[model samples]
Target: MRIGYWWRLAATALLGLASMSQASETAEAGNLVYTSGSQGSALHLGTRLDINVQGLQAQVRVAQRFQNTSSEWVNAAYVYPLAEDSAVSGLKMLVGERVIVGEIKEKAEARKTFEAAKASGKKATLVEQQRPNLFRQEVANIAPGEIIEVHLVYSQQVIYDAGEFRLRLPTTLTPRYIPGVSRAELLGSASVHTGASGWSLPTDQVEDAHLITPAQHHNTPGRLLNPMSLNLALNAGMPLAKVNSATHKLAIEKPAGAAQGVRSIQFAAGEVSMDRDIELSWLPEPQAAPVAAQFVSQWQGERYAQLMLMPPRELAEHQVLPRELILIVDTSGSMAGNSIEQARASSLLALNQLTERDRFNVIFFSSSTHTVFEQAVAATPANLASARQAIERMRADGGTEMHSALSRAFDHDSSGEHLQQIVFVTDGSVGNESALLTLIHRCLGDARLFTVAIGSAPNRFFMRRAAEFGRGSFTEIATADQVQERMAGLLSKLQKPVVANVQIDWPQPVEAFPRTVPDLYWGEPILVTAKLPPWPSRSDARVVITGESAGKPWQRELVLSAGEAPLADVGVPVLAQRFGREKIAFLEDEAYRAGNSEQARDTVLPVALQYQLMSRFTSLVAVDKTPSRPAQVTAKDGAIANAMPAGSGMQAVGYPQTANGLLWHLLMGALALVGLLVLNSRGVVYVRTEFTAAAGRS
Candidate 1:
């Protein structure tokens, strides 16, 4: 199947621009007016832009105000507000005139085109996109003089190295519709201001710098300018700054030879707060280890599924141990931003971990693919250095082509003497998980695969699944700060093979078994638990397990005695299998959400309810709905003894209270309304409005 075609469809749906089978129109009630405003908290040095710092949360308030601008009575549904062109700058790195890095496009059309182009061996181009990490959308209705309020809370990662930060927020009010007037008028003069410290400059300074010029005196003028670049020579030590203009935000530049320090920049447009934070630290000296290995694993049951680590180890007996390694990195357009900085750091760390005994190669794919050291190379110092240099010089410029990368990684040629392994590191933003999974199933080999996830919200699903399919492990680096340590831990796992072709069996038919056994790595102990039939009631059950050690296969057996009971007992293995199944189902639900298929979304509900499960996008809340009834009347006393009679027990109803539910409801309503409008326009259904008054003496 062509993956690109599906990608485009998904992308367009996400952007709310796709011409689906549904149509919608704006409906207003009363003289309702909605207004929103945003504020920024911090600033960055290199660029005079607001950045969300690691430990700081930014606040944004969206308020809906209702006013009787018209002399009519009416009631209406809630008004949903969406922010247009809500773009944050300064935190992004620009190439030439374009914001080359750090822009996320939610446009379905552009995404479709991009995915299509990728499949056709062409570059996926982005027409327009927004910052995916920071933005807001809200909907609500109000009666005359009634106001509803909402707050958008979020945090941003500091991407630059600097000591100061700043933010400026400017707001405006617009009406959905006017009864008499063709257009809405400005409610009042709007102003910008700062709330607290950690920033310098007052509200007036920003207004003065951003106000309209007297020479061009134009009414209803909006003046927001995207500055080409900032000049950062003058401001050195200030840790915060802001520029609040309805038309333009502050432009900051980095000066040569500036001292390193933490900085934050903020921009506020009415009720929206956009920030960019910079964390500056002195670059540390390069360090290398002769050989090292590390392992990390969470407990599954009484035993463990080991994630093995070994820089180097001697082979035991006649075991056939072969080595394989694959390196996959994202060179997509988004990665063109500070992502390159982190990628280079991680690549270099991986190279340092290789030893002379191992064989490995590097694969860099974006719109295309490139390999270093020509095929797989020996882990000699000369080859390692060359590989390191090649990765450091790598640049980000292309759309993601994940399928091709995986296919090539699994097809790498390996000698039979060493164990095979693949290390995949990426931001994981592609929309073709199914296709990748199919390829993984086809390419299953003795080789294990490890995944290193990069970026703020990298695709955890892909990382975890890829590792599981390849029989390896997965790790993540949330920021550039954690790249080194995370990479080091992953590399250390390749030293030795812990267990090979391990299997377990019981003398009598076992009641329960683990769906799959965890692969044992070097330096890790083996632990397995199984359930036997009720003890004492049945003969002592014996269990047997076997696996290859060195060149010979080994076996072990155990007998358990238990008394038979009237009630069934839960075994460790049974519980482990149940947990594994639940986890797998959760991952599938996540994939469905990301795919955005109506069928998939619908299917998740039943499974979720069956599991009594709550995922990242779902929650189950219980509500009591007991009706209150009037007290019973006694004929003799003609007085009430009790206020109310006992009613049916409180009923519990399951209600979905997540963003997904809200989206589903909105989509359904829009579809129904579109259908009604179509019929009315076609003369199939007649629609009319009439006003009637009750008879009264005037």
Candidate 2:
């Protein structure tokens, strides 16, 4: 009977091979499969796949050709070929005893209920028993005739974390299976094989065979299977080797003379830990001398004098007056996950920071807008609690209609007579950044816009530009955990404007002038620096600065007398632009180079190199040839620490720590303890639990 079955299979395989050869020839000749119908149930193009199966092992090769018969360029859109139901149900990949993929679902009713829930807009959450190292989406951008190659390597098990996944390979097995072409086929069979390397154990000592199936794919009619399975044959005669339970590492010692009269032993390298250090620095160095005279000239006559305007240094010592503020929060679909959670927590923290004298309103926006308070309400406990409750109840949904949100935020009815301010918190994913800018141009007043960008990948350019256009400050909350700290720091800056509408005038023709100064947010002092023409001694340089104060105008003049001292010519404008451009370029380059490797290396590298060269403005310097390391980080703790010396319109501020780093250390220690327990159970170490009959013996 076995001989007859083998002969029958051989004949069937020969016929299949012959048909596959013809299909290959046709595919090589540039045959195309065009779109057939506009409606459903149409004969969409189909392709014949040639699969080679040998004793429970299979290799599949598919040659698909798509054509765009439509007038417009048709996207090769959706083309999915299903696998045989029974064969896939029993399939399993084995790395030791763990099944990486392919476990059939036992409960049909439960599966149907899950499918229903998923279809009904309920969240489909899947736990990762094993994670794959490379999770590739099968379909992306497929142009007409885009003959893409989709390849996958099945492994026994995989590991996963919150951000990444990992795959584990078997010791001595290459179990490859061919994916079938039928969308609905239950009865399926693959030829079985017994080779020295393919079998879980030596073929000579083969004992029992077990087939594993993917749990999610079992009995489910779907073209895509996440975890595929494999068949394994164990050696019964050979005693299962005792593996050390404490180590969590597999230990295998080969039988004597198993291979070429030599004994082989193997051990798994448990876990790996790595550390990476990042350093940031600058290019050229500037002189230590202050550029006060140069900054005065550039701001002599400007429309927004508040930006360059400076208050008395003594203001830091004085108590700031009570101000009214509005916090605009974006709770749209784009902010649905972690972003919305972070925004809510940050808003609550901001509310808590408000003093009794200050008044505030909280506005949440999705497709529509809602306010916690109609107008700015005093920072009373009752009002603040009400606002906090509203923020807590906010749910992320709907489209990102940002214009409507901004319009409501800047409406005259929302304004307060006392220091009016609007704090816009969002991930800034709106498509209409330009439109928002136009609106900001029209809404310019005493109100300043402070932006809090929340998310890993945020639209920094839009947020920064909006803040610039609205005469406010821009801040990024890089992580959900860091939202509260970053938002608080930003609010601290909005307490009072340090300088307003500052202007500078030069007596002699200065070599160059910095066109603009960075917006001086509250809690930050304003400092503008400029470069002077080559003076024949110090007497040839002088500049005048003018700006508005607390409802008043003021001016300041500085003189440079020509002397025997060495005159250092610093290009203040160039330095300022270099820093600004570098920041802007960083955001742009990161966006463009999101996933493309070659383009990022070719384009962003050169730009980053140039930025590294130009950032050295006396105070900060880049020591390494590479732009990765920053040599010295000056402390900006004091009031004047971040203040740009007279001529340079740039401030060197310290990167703030969002959360206490010490907390991470504690968390890591806990993880290490858990890892130790896992290792101990594997017999790598022994743990003793001591217990005594408490007072009975006494």
Best by TM-score: 1
- What is the overall TM-score of model 2 with all chains considered together? 0.39
Model 2 stretches with alpha carbons more than 4 Å out: 1-319, 414-416, 507-519, 522-698
lDDT of 1: 0.36
| Poorest lDDT segment (10 consecutive residues) of candidate 2 | 635-644
Tens-place lDDT per residue, model 2, 1-698, is: 12222233233333333322111111111112121222111112222223332111233332222332323222221212121100111122222223222222222332343334333332111111100110101111222332332222221111111111111121101011111111101212211110001101111111111011100001112321111222212111222222121112333344654432122222243211100000011111123112131112221121111112233432352445577778899876556566678788888888887888888898888656888877788899999989989999998665455777788778735334477778888877543344466677677566778888665335554676678667778766645545655576676677665556766676665423234444344434343323344545445355566665453565666664432321244212222322333343343334332432123334433433332221111011101111211223111000000111111111111111111111222233344445555766887753432111110000
Off by over 4 Å in 1: 1-322, 334-339, 380-382, 479-484, 505-514, 522-609, 614-698
TM-scores of all models?
0.42, 0.39
Per-residue accuracy of model 1 over 187-266 as CA lDDT, tens digit each? 11111110000001111111111111000001112422111122112222223333122223433333355433223232
lDDT of each: 0.36, 0.37
lDDT of 2 at 591: 36
